[model samples]
Target: MDYIDRAEATRRILAAKERAGLSFEELAQVVGAHEVWVASALLGQNTMSSEQAAAAGKALALDEATVAALSRDAARGSLPAAVPTDPLIYRFHEIVQVYGTTLKAVIEEKFGSGIMSAIDFSMDIDRVDDPRGDRVKVTLNGKFLPYRTW
Candidate 1:
């Protein structure tokens, strides 16, 4: 509850899971946590809030006392020591951060009023086997709908 070293708390919480004989993936599945988060928490690379720690504790079948201890541990933490090395998918995000305004203006200019329907959207990924190396292909499909008239 007091000033907890974020890094230290992460270690203790993760140790709790490990002592339960659960692998990172297994513990994540049990606690409904993302495997990445579980891994980070254990490695003292990621911090959590009281709520998150409590939830994780409950998921790991930790006792009430342990849950309380973790809840206190959750706060007073920062991000993972190392940033994830993987590249972020930027195309989809462009719709939110970059082209969002421009696209809105363009759509308003072309159509009376409309939006792309996520409900009708679809995605497909192809895993191709190659003698040189594997290849991943991705495709997206979606329907566009105009806003209702007055």
Candidate 2:
């Protein structure tokens, strides 16, 4: 298995993280990035600089090769299948299926012929206690890029 498979390196890092008993927050502090970003990078959803990778490796006690793998540019959005089979991931797919058009329409109306950028985005997740149950509060902040005319 290779890093390109998106499992080998990640698995090693996860093992080290477990052994260290370090939370994502603590690891993020060492990596000098936001927790969500650090998590995403580790999950192969984003790329990390050499320094960031070295820091992460040092903090996680990963091998140099794994650290080098972490620094490589990833082929992003490589899913196992077209539609995910995982229940939680499937729910997100369902959300997009049900509301994707609605979201596009509303975003166009508000942002004006523009689209939100995942490249230049920030996300935050929080836990909110509710009378019914604990709620997951997620905030996605993205820069809006308007369509350009020739």
Q: How high is each candidate's TM-score?
A: 0.36, 0.90
- Candidate 2 per-residue C-alpha lDDT over 28-47 given as tens digits, one digit per residue, 9 for 90 to 100: 99999999999888877778
Q: Any residue pairs clashing in model 2, and if so which?
A: none
Ten residues in sequence with the least summed lDDT for candidate 2:
1-10
- Candidate 2: residue 126 lDDT (0-100): 96
Q: Which candidate is the best by TM-score?
A: 2
Best by lDDT: 2
- Provide the lDDT at 67 for model 2: 87
Q: Estimate every model's Cα lDDT from 0 to 1.
A: 0.60, 0.86
Model 2 sits at a Cα RMSD from the real structure of 2.4
What tens-digit string does per-residue lDDT give for candidate 1 at 1-150?
344454555556667666777777776675566665656554544445567666677666655554544434334233344543445544445445677799778867877588876556555656899999997775655677898878
Colliding pairs, model 1: 45-80
Identify the runs in model 2 with alpha carbons over 4 angstroms from their true place.
1-6
Q: RMSD of candidate 1 to the true fold? A: 9.0
Q: Count the backbone clashes (under 3 Å) in each candidate.
A: 1, 0
